[model samples]
Target: MAGVGSEKVFENDKVIVWNFVLEPGEETPVHTHEHSYMWYAIEGAPLHIYDKDGADLGIFEVPTGAVYSLKCQDGYLEVLSEIGKGARVPATHKARNDGDRPYREVLVEYKDAMPAGGSV
Candidate 1:
């Protein structure tokens, strides 16, 4: 699903960049990420994760200037080694701002040779 307020800032063959902004009590629509991506936190704030049915997943902290590399299946895994297999299909989730301030972050998604079978 398309994110409610996510904007594609830049895109190329190798990478696609997205800018996300959530105000107080704002939320992003149910969406899925189909590629390996990293995020840079701009305005850190409290956020809540939810499933497609709107079930509360958990609360997560968005630290300022924090960098996170997220795999498809695993949400946030430590990159101990550079050699490892990645997921073919990415993960899906929704996010909401539970804090009193705004939440901002930059996401850089790396396109991995396109979809194998075909584009969804």
Candidate 2:
């Protein structure tokens, strides 16, 4: 939950936070998000794909320190659920769905935040 509630702290056109690193030879399998994403590749090279229902959508390469935002409108990524709500992804630094795909990222979703004039 990140200790956040369903309330407005402020308003914005959009917001997201994340960090990622990849060792040589890695990729993140096709996945979906409910909010949206601006994937900023911090370190290492990564190959990203937008997929829906086990089908191919599009392929993207995110190099170190790059950013990309993905949404259902962009393509069909069979969204299973929303982020920061109830859907929980398996904590990384642990499992592997399929070998050869090792995309990693630190994610933060839009939610209630510090009020105005609040120090972060």
Estimate every model's Cα lDDT from 0 to 1. Answer: 0.66, 0.35
User: In candidate 2, what residue range of length 10 has the lowest lDDT sum?
Assistant: 90-99
List model 1 lDDT by residue over 1-120, tens digit each: 246437988889888888989998988877876666677789888878776678876777777777666555454322211222231222556778989988888877768743342221
User: What TM-score does structure 2 among the candidates reach?
Assistant: 0.38
Off by over 4 Å in 1: 74-90, 113-120
Error of 1 at 25 (Å): 0.5
Give the top-scoring candidate (TM-score).
1
lDDT of 2 by residue, 1-120 (tens): 222112323345455454443444543443344453333444423343323333433333444444443332233322222221222232211212122444454444433432243211
Per-model TM-score on C-alpha atoms = 0.75, 0.38
Q: Which sections of candidate 2 miss by over 4 Å?
A: 1-31, 48-50, 70-104, 112-120
Cα RMSD of all models vs. native, in order, equals 6.8, 11.5
